[model samples]
Target: MIETIVLDIGETITRDDRYWASWADWLSVPRHTLSALVGAVVARGLDNAEALRLMRPGIDVAAEYRAREAAGRGEYLDDSDLHEDVRPALAALRAAGARVVIAGNQTVRAGELLRGLGLPADLVVTSGEWGVAKPHPEFFQRVLEVAQAPARATVYVGDHPANDVFPARAAGLRVAHLRRGPWGHLWAGDPEVVAAADWCIDSLMELRTIVGG
Candidate 1:
């Protein structure tokens, strides 16, 4: 039985359109240009933040983040940013006696924003809070700890193959590759992603069937 469900934030629980657009505005770059650069890095398996550095060589990305906030535009995700299926799906999972956790590689301010949204979850945490990011073994270890259930009985769902499918599966957690984000839509047909994910789903609503009532 899937007693716990852990989900990634960006492009999993939410759409990433606003995120990329905001960054483009912050950096004074064209939206399409920033988006294309992000895809390039993602395709090359480099960190997405490399897109920002690529836009402004030697730019202090972290400092820029603070500046953006001080200028009244930092990390922001509102009700509209959440995927339509998020609240319903999470609520159903909890009603089925499953623990729902929202975990992802997001900033501390992003964590505060997420918690402020009050999504139906047992816990909403970020890598900034944990000091460990995905594709790292320690991150999955912390996932298991938050789950408080055996890895085999927990499911970790996300859009990124390298960060979500492989490592989560390797860590003994059942994996669900969600096909809603760019990384997901782009890599959905990749052989390794297909092999690593125990379940490949197109929407969070499908999760109700996976865990079952």
Candidate 2:
């Protein structure tokens, strides 16, 4: 029986549209242009780590864009309507005695996002707060310590193959891949890592079947 359900917030629970849309006004460039630039950077042989470093400068621009957008529109990015069944699905897991925790890499702003969306999570673990990010076993270790649950009894659900599944598996937890729209295709292309996961599902709502809701 799965005693705990750990989740990644951004792409796993919330859709990617909100993130991309938030960037549209921030960079003062078209969203497609930014996406193309990201592809270009990756195509130029920059590894994911390097591309992230290169993109760090754009964070300030994004912040300004978000501020302006908020002022003009009076609304922040919309977390795609929570999956219709997510709330009840999560409640079912909890009813089955599973502890739910959210482990993610975010600035201190994560709490606001979680509370803002009214997502149900028993604990929120963040790299910004811990000084370490996913794919690093230490991040999971810290969460394990806090959750006080055995790794074997926990299942981590996330979107990224490397950052989510692999590291959690290394830490001895079952992993569920949240294979949503486009990003799902990107992850599926990675045969080796995708194979590492115990199960993959198209949505959070499907997790109950995987872990026996």
lDDT for each candidate structure: 0.93, 0.67
RMSD of 1: 1.1
What would the per-residue lDDT of candidate 2 be over residues 1-213, giving only the tens digit for each residue?
Answer: 677888876666655555555455454567776565555654453433333335455445446545765676423434453555567777777666778887777655654556576566677667878889887889999868766678887888887776787888989988887776344446665776567787887767777776674
Error of 1 at 35 (Å): 1.2
- For every candidate, C-alpha RMSD to the true structure in Å: 1.1, 3.9
Worst lDDT 10-window in candidate 2: 45-54
Q: Each prediction's TM-score against the native?
A: 0.97, 0.78
Residue-level lDDT tens digits of model 1 in 5-93: 99999999988899999999988899999999999998888888899889999999889988999999988889999999999999998
Question: Mind sharing the TM-score for model 1?
Answer: 0.97
Candidate 2 regions off by >4 Å?
A: 38-85
